[model samples]
Target: MKREIVLLAMFTMAIIFMAGCKQHGTPKPRGYYRIAFPEHDYKPFNKKSPYTFDLPVYTEVGDGAQPQTREKYWYNINYPNLNGILHISYKAVDNNLNEMLEDSRKLAYKHSVKADAIAERLFISADKNVYGTLFDIKGDAASPVQFYLTDSVRNFVRGSLYFNSVPNKDSLAPVIDFVKTDIVHLMETFEWKEMPKL
Candidate 1:
């Protein structure tokens, strides 16, 4: 009877070992958190400013030239929900159009080390006399978008998009695309303010 009890215990142990060795497939890849995007509705920003454009209603326009000296028309489109900001700076053309254009190009290329590619798309509105180039940067660059709108004679406005968090192109792709559309809308509605007589 004792011998039979020992054999039964061994058999049970063997069955448990066989059950633990069943096939297990490879581990699944990690995933990122889902982001909730707001509606794409926008409103005209035709306030008492040097220029006017349409911006998303979800954002706020604030002075970007503060803490140094508040310049004439330097502002930022703040995206509180997405932790991002679009810095816009206006410069009056005073025989420095070439230099200004060069500066804008250099600024966009600064991220070439980290960016996989930089695409420049020309924008022109003959009726509005708006002309500019939009820079769409790919990869893990700090700033994914930079653009400049100019009348090519008297007004030059440069804008750049930056995030408050770490640079992760893959994770930020959706937000970047959404903001890109808004930026394009802004360029479409952009108009330069007439300079006062000197």
Candidate 2:
């Protein structure tokens, strides 16, 4: 009888333990996540850095890499380390500068639609209203170059680029800010292709 009672008690205890083990509601997994960013070992542009701020040597000015339709005219600077590319262009818009800024927000959303992460990105305020885009390897290879369009006769400019990876916005903030500084420098140095001096 005692043996039978002990077995019964054990069974009851097991039942209670199992019941407790069974999650009452939705159970979450157990694990820790780590987010690590690389160290910043960058160099400034070799040519006269018409603009301020030091750009990474991993970045280099390249020939017109973007197609013609992208904008009237645009150029690219390769960011090989980050496996990224920065494409910049100028396009005249019918609307004014304010309207362009509003539209820029829409453009960013449109670009993010196809990407996985927002990546390091932001707006250009140090100089003018130049919309910027940075990407992280999220999906099939995407154009790392961000395209910006402006109507401000005072400063009609557009800039775009693609990041090597689908970068998280929070993590890339510093880098993006640094890139923006260079872009501002680019704007200052921006000289419309000499129109044959006609």
Candidate 3:
């Protein structure tokens, strides 16, 4: 009887081991929170700013927060849901167009230490007489996008995009791609609202 009991216990242990072997546990793959993107719709930024562009419906235009931005026609395009801001600084192109252009280049390149790559795309709209360069910065940079628009005579506007959260290229990839499209739309529709006097 004792021998039968031992045999029964061994059989039960064998069944349990076989059952456990049939199913394997795996660690869940790392993941990020699912993002709900807004529909793409834009309205004209018809405010009294020196320039005008079509702004995405999701954004709000407000005065810039930097001290240097004060009284400089600087503005911030705030994304409430995305927790991002696009800083726009407008400067009249007196005789400092060269300086402004160089400054913009410098600002965009400042992220080179953290960025894997920096791409410059030339923008030209001969009919509107608006020309500029858009800087697309990739990797873990603080600012992922920077651009400058100029009539090459009267107006120069520089813009940089920054997220309110920590910079994580992998996690922010989707949001970055989405916002990049909006920035391109803004640039494509950009125009000088006021003509310079001769």
Pick by lDDT: which candidate is best? Answer: 3
Whose lDDT is higher: candidate 2's or candidate 3's? 3
Per-candidate TM equals 0.89, 0.43, 0.88
Best by TM-score: 1
Per residue, candidate 1 scores C-alpha lDDT tens digits across 1-198 of 999999999999999888877856789886777889888999988555667898899999988787767567888999999999999998888999999999999999999999999999999998888999999999999999999999989888999999998999888999999999999999998987776442
Q: Decide which is better by lDDT, 1 or 3.
A: 3
Encode model 2's per-residue lDDT on 15-68: one tens digit a residue. Answer: 999999897787787543343435444554443211222454547777553564
Q: Which residue pairs in candidate 1 have backbone atoms (N, alpha carbon, C) closer than 3 angstroms, thus clashing? A: none
Which 10 residues in a row give candidate 2 its minimum summed lDDT?
A: 189-198
**What would you estimate as the lDDT of candidate 2?**
0.50
- In order of TM-score, best first, we have 1, 3, 2
Model 1 TM-score? Answer: 0.89
- lDDT tens per residue, model 3, 35-151: 999999999996667789999998999987477535556788998999999998888888998999999999999999999999999999999989999999999999999999999
